[model samples]
Target: MFLPEAWGRGYATEACTAVLDWFAGALPGEPVVLYTQSANTSSMRLSAKLGFTELERFEAWGAEQWFGVWSPLTLSG
Candidate 1:
């Protein structure tokens, strides 16, 4: 997560990319899942950029939630 003051600076994207790369190297065939509020557009964009595909959307905690999954195989094409 990034501070509101740090929004739009690409920090989230960079950090997430690094983490995902590490996960892919460490867990070849395993998948990674991410959950975020539907309203958080930045997170949605980041997930898409990192190759996450939406698995489901449901209401929880009074707000819509997004569930996505990513795998190294998917990224490798």
Candidate 2:
């Protein structure tokens, strides 16, 4: 995780993209799953930007959490 001071500047986007690219290359067409609290708007936006689709939402640990999934095919043309 990066320091709070490093929140913007696209670093997360770049790092996450690189990681996802590696995962896709390693496992052809596997999907990636993500979970985050609904209250985290930044995470929600990030998930959408990363092409993750909402799979479900549930209550956990006294908070509303969302489960999303991203498939390599999502952005593959």
Candidate 3:
């Protein structure tokens, strides 16, 4: 996660892309997942760019709202 003050500088997107590359190269075919709160539209968009699909919303930690599951194809180079 990143501080809200750091939004729009492409840090999350860039880091996610890099991490995706490393993970795919290191563990080829392994599954990956990312979950973020519902209010985090930025993160939701980031996940979409990285090919993450919203799997389900559940109340696990806080006030009931989360996104989950990212496809392995998201790690494509």
For model 3, name the residue pairs that clash: none
User: What shift in Å separates residue 55 of candidate 1 from its native position after superposition?
Assistant: 0.4
Candidate 3 structure quality by residue, lDDT tens digits, 1-77: 77888878888788887887788778877878776787777877787787877788888677556666655565444
On residues 1-77, what C-alpha lDDT tens digit does candidate 1 reach at each position?
67899888988788888998898899888999999999999889999988999999999999999999998887864
lDDT for 3 (candidate 3) = 81
Q: Candidate 2: deviation at residue 4, Å?
A: 6.2
lDDT for each candidate structure: 0.91, 0.90, 0.75
Q: Return the TM-score for each candidate structure.
A: 0.85, 0.87, 0.72
Could you give the candidate ranking by TM-score, starting with the highest? 2, 1, 3
Query: Could you tell me the TM-score of candidate 2?
Result: 0.87
Backbone steric clashes in candidate 3, count: 0
Over all chains combined, what TM-score does candidate 1 have?
A: 0.85
Where's the lowest-lDDT run of ten residues in candidate 1? 68-77
lDDT of 2 by residue, 1-77 (tens): 77888779788778888899899899978999999999999899888888899999999999999999999987754
Rank the candidate models, highest lDDT first.
Answer: 1, 2, 3
